[model samples]
Target chain A: MARVLIVEDEMLVAMLIEDVIVDLGHEVVGPAMRLETALEVVEAENVDFAILDINLAGKQSFPVADRLADLGVPFIFASGYGAAGLNERHRQAQVVQKPFAPDQIASLLERL
Target chain B: MILQNDTPNIDPFRFLGKDGEAAEIIRTYDWSSTPLGRVEEWPPCLRTSTALLLQSPVPIVMLWGEEGVMIYNDAYSVFAGSRHPALFGSNVREGWAEIVDFNDNVMKVGLAGGTLAYRDQELTLHRKGFPEQVWMDLDYSPVLDEEGKPAGVIAIVVETTERVLAERRNREEYERLQNLFSQAPTFMAMTSGPEHTFEMVNPEYQTLVGDRQVVGKTLVDAMPEIAKQGYLDLMDDVFKTGKTVRRAAERVMFARTKDAPLVERYVDFVYQPIRDERGAVVSIFTQGSDVTERVRAENHQKLLINELNHRVKNTLTSIQSIVTQTLRGVQTREEASKAITNRILALSRAHNVLTAENWDGAELRAMVVSSLEAFQVESREAIRINGPDLRVGPHAAMSIALALHELATNAAKYGALSFSDGSVDVSWQLLGDKFELDWIERDGPTVVPGDRKGFGSRLLLQVLPLELQGTATIDYRPDGVAFNFATSLEAVNDRPALEGV
Candidate 1:
């Protein structure tokens, strides 16, 4: 099992997502609730892949997504808007529609 | 051959109906220079034809004998264009030298026992002082003597210059309108009949549909894809009812390349019926514009709202998960469930305030009332809310709401709200960029400071500071419990405070 970074703003949502990650036998890194913290964790933590909430609080998680892409880290976008909400640069990136179950995260991680 | 003295006494002059100015001119004309001798000397066929020509209501002329001299009616004087009285007995070549070549054809045909007629013939005639253009309908027929031989050419002329020019102008105007119709910027098409055949389409439509063979083809025949998307039905409905149809934005999948995926597009369009003079629908004018970009931007905004809604739903799910997970790790289920339900209810109250303002934020006064409103005493005097209105973002509002709910719950159970003499004053102040809220309880049961790490203690003393990105402290005195919290105003919603009393 690999360590995964969880970037979600809603505290309970972030916790539940961490629970799902732990349930899948993976060590979770910073479940950052904001874009700045997510970027800092992505830079500081030794993580294999990232689970990015497209909207981190009021700001977009695009900088974190872009930073992860620059570092050649595989990541999946978790958004309620599905793939259409993504920009042209991340159009082909893996997407997990929001309010996802633990197995969907596991499967996405497996694919990554 | 001059007929000055024998003008009114001659057989043809006196024998025929010598009415009108043309007859007077002819009876007195000097014909010595022309081939015709005189009115009295003209052959019987010529004399009889001259009388008919003079009495004609329409313009008429006679070019008689081998020399082809002119003799015309008064009506013909107008067609002669100022070549009137002098032209009555002048040679046709000498009088109308400008169009003599045309007259030569007429004379050659008429005198050779062939009739020649021209309708609305355009010719320039030398008349008055200038060579003028004129259109005329002319008929030339040969007249025969008693021996049945072709004697002279009789011409029936009617100038139609005004009518011809008017018709030309009308045709030119029609052509100009046609030019505009073909090149208009907006997509335009005219479809006729139940089949909605494309009667005409402009260049915009041609390019829009990828230059498909649309004109002279039915709508379904031209583009079969629209039939599946209810477009065919809509068009049929509009045509049958003659009612206009306008779609603000419709998504269409256009297949631009073979074997490739359908390209999605958005368009705003209208179908307007064109009626005939009888008020019957003859065709439909289809006009529209591509609105894909605007529609996409609108959908993006909708997605953002939907994401917010999803977050709300997910928060509810998370609360459920918390309650269920806490049940597995708790000492008393009833107390834990009660506390969880109460906290969740407070969060919902905060959400209600935020929802009312389109999720932008919630006011602190409203948030306070919503959090403690459920634990209300019989009299409103038990609780005093005094604060300048503060709007805080959803995260901070939720934290503040839960903190107040916990404090109020503790007061109701053990501090102030449990007794009739109890009262709680909730107040807040904004100093520079710092926002601070205070809760003071009085005239209640004696406070017993506990060292236990209960859910209420952890929630009130720790969660408020952590959640709102602020700080909080609680003090227990002999009379009641008091709490004070401070946070950055910027972290809360940034709206002007309502004037407070």
Candidate 2:
């Protein structure tokens, strides 16, 4: 089972995604709710993979994505605006729009 | 008087050239009936001049002495239109009857040993059996007799009608283009050469640059800031490549006057290159419209749409969380369904409160009243809610609304509302930077504390304080359940949702 990290700001969304990740037979890392916290988790943990929300409160999570890329950890972005919201650097990365089904997350985890 | 028959043996008309129609016309004409009499009596100057003009290709006509009699060659016949053979020996005044006075001036000037010339002279003539307007370049010089005295006027006529009319049409077309350039709604400018000198600037273009006198000045000279913004480079690229450059909704900074502050504006523009006949770039034509207001409105709309999408997605996830946890806690499908509807309704009611405030912030009193609206109305009067006028940010307001719903739900089920005489007191205040709120139940059934770690208790004890970045507690008192919450005022009145994103 892969150790997946969740970086989402919405409290229930984070919890719901955490539940989904655990149900997919994977160990869960931080469901970091802020950019700084996500970056800290990426630096401190032996993360195998990550699911990043594009927005954190009023801030963007691109810096977290950058840190994850630097650590050679693969990740996908989850956002309400979908892939259109990603900047130039991360535009080609995988994206899963919010209000996602558990099965969508499960299939993505299997691919990871 | 000289006689033509006496000179017939000498062949007096021998000087007339053997080629052209004018030579035959002169030979067969009855010149003896005119004042100059016959060809044998003609002066040597007239004979020599007529012969010389007849062989020449230019249109030439000579008027002999006294009555100014007309003599011309083949070329002049075409210039005469249809008034040819009938005009051979006719007097100059009656030959071109429409311009009799104009020819009269020419006759008097030439016979007096003076010369006259007119370029593109406009005149009316009936050469075609009808009056027609024409233009000609006419030159008149006196032809002297053998005695070196003024004798007759020799004239050369060149019709300039076609050229004059073409020039007039060209001028009219140029004026029409000038009018369009001046009145166009879009700004337009022409800059020439590598210096990008502004050669032409219409009124709309003038207004775009705050009516600056930009004509004849290089773009860098008139607006150095624009050059710094890299528009000068763009123009140079277009000039060198002879290609067109288009930009849309691009930001530019401008100041109305030298002392004024720079204001940001957006524009949609094109730079088109003008080429010479050799296909070399010579000038850049710039045309565009100031689109600051349109761009700003579009940006605001995009922000609103994104904000709306984010909120909707988050609210759906909140409902998802409610449904999943509710189903896990309930004993039956009926109980789960009722609890899911109630939770979603609570969330929807909170959204209404936030929407009323445009999602900026909500009044604490409004949140309190709306959250308790679903409870038993007979018990609403018993629920005392007292708080100073306070505004909480959208996230804080939504969390507090849900937390209050949970507490009231518990009160209606087993606390204050379950007993008719029971009542609840809810109050909040701000002291310095810290905020404090209290919900105390009195005169209710004795509360039985249970280790119920359900969705409602989790929201009250965990999510509310975590979201608000503060502390919250619920005490199962023997009389009722009491809940107290405290956080910083800044956390309660946080920045509006969707700001800076």
Candidate 3:
């Protein structure tokens, strides 16, 4: 089982994702809420894979994504604004929209 | 025919009496101090010419003898400004000290048998309290003595000050109006003739037209971009019929920016006909303003508002998903109602946490506490939670809230919370590249695994792991129930996009 990290800001949405992670039988790392917090977690924690919210408290999480990329950790972006809202550097990364099925996240995690 | 001054037949008042006003002034003037000392001693030629000057309606002054002593008529007095009655017998030099040089020139020329004339000779004279400007057309003719020698000069003066000043003021006013037109904040242009040739365009209009040469060129030749745009036609229509045409706003492309691709601008304008005497339309007047920025800002706001509506609709759909999932595979109506209501409340509670943070995220500790608080499991230390300060995203927060509510309800009914002394310990730790959370129950009834999969079991075994991109397990130990959940940090922390409405 792979360890997964969740970085989103909405509590309800994060919880739904957690329920799915648990069922997938993989170890869970963190659901970082702020970009700075996510960056710190990526630095201090042994995170094998990560899920980044394109926005963290209205701030872009690209820096955290960059740190995760440097360490060879796998990750995907999820945002309400979609791929068009992502920075040019990450426009091609995996993305899932809101109100998504748990299976969508599961399938992506399996690929990672 | 020459008459001597002493001739009995000659009349002393003969030459002076012909002009009533001049005759009165010269008869009364005191001339005892100088050459041609008195009126009776004046030379015969001087007297005759002075009489002729008096009768003439034009302003004239007759200066006789070496001193050029002045003798003038009523018209001459008015042209002399304020130096009138006092100057009747005074020398020309004394009366016209301000323009003595000019008068000196005239005297020298006239006495040498040369005629002198000047048109619009300008001078500044302190005639009143302040200096007054004056212009005149002057003519000086020499009058000979009885011996035919040059003796005196007759000056004909016509003041043109009022006319010159009026003309000057008219030119100044025209220039002032031109200044206002160029400096005005709006675009202005004047087109004449049927072809709508540009007669005039102010600086504001020039800037709006960019690098194009507008003035002296027809509308199409100057701003060809607007030829088919109907602006030239509008000017033509207004010019041909003396009618006014006004447009509130029109999008026109003037290629205002110096680039290959042109930019369109919205302008509010009016074209009016200028009519001369007899009401014939002479020219077309156009005025306009650029409204591009204001219109674009308004359109951008509308776009943002539409996006906001779509986002709100997506959030509502998320609520629908929670409600739909909770009602699945329920036994009784009462059971179903309880389950659905409790799940919705769980979702709402998570929503509340996210709302407090502007839907950014929530604290994991806070999410756990608030989610289980609905069941009163934490009262009297019945439940314990252990973890560092970890933040949870909105998506995870909502799912976990419902999952936690389901877990607590199961514990209350069949596990640790079913008995008074029973307790539940919820703790989490970060493993290498993985996050682990455990829910262990203790001191309750003997635990047995459920043979059939219920909604809660399906969520724990299937839905939860799928949503988190991780794994979870339930152990039906004889003492109590224990559930351990783990997932990758990346999966849980990832952002989600908003689905379209």
Best model per DockQ:
2
TM per candidate comes to 0.55, 0.73, 0.57
In model 1, which runs have C-alpha deviations exceeding 4 angstroms? Answer: A1-5, A18-31, A44-50, A72-78, A82-84, A89-112, B1-38, B42-169, B172-305, B308-312, B325-333, B414-423, B440-467, B473-482, B494-501
lDDT for each residue of candidate 1 in A56-105, tens digit (9 for 90 to 100): 55677899989999999999987765786688889898888766667888
lDDT of 1 by residue, B389-485 (tens): 7767776676677668768988988998888889899999999999888999998888886543454565566445544556888888667988898
Instruction: Give candidate 2's error at residue B144 in angstroms.
Output: 3.2
Q: Which has the higher TM-score value, candidate number 1 or candidate number 3?
A: 3
lDDT of 1 at A32: 74
Backbone clash pairs for candidate 2 read none
Chain A TM-scores, all candidates? 0.94, 0.96, 0.93
lDDT (C-alpha) at residue B375 in model 2: 81
Of candidates 2 and 1, the better by TM-score = 2
lDDT of each residue in B318-408, candidate 2, tens digit only: 7887887778788999988988898889888988998998888899999988988778455257788999999988777878888888899
Docking class of 1: incorrect
Regions more than 4 Å wrong, model 2: A1-7, A14-52, A64-78, A81-112, B2-5, B27-41, B63-69, B91-93, B129-133, B145-149, B167-312, B353-368, B376-392, B421-452, B475-482, B495-497
Q: Count clashes in each candidate, considering only residues at least 3 apart in sequence or on different chains.
A: 2, 0, 89
* i-RMSD of all predictions: 6.2, 2.2, 7.6
Interface RMSD, Å, model 1: 6.2
lDDT of 2 at B306: 82
Query: Of the true interface contacts, what fraction does each candidate have?
Result: 0.13, 0.41, 0.08
TM-score of chain B of each: 0.54, 0.76, 0.65
Best by TM-score: 2
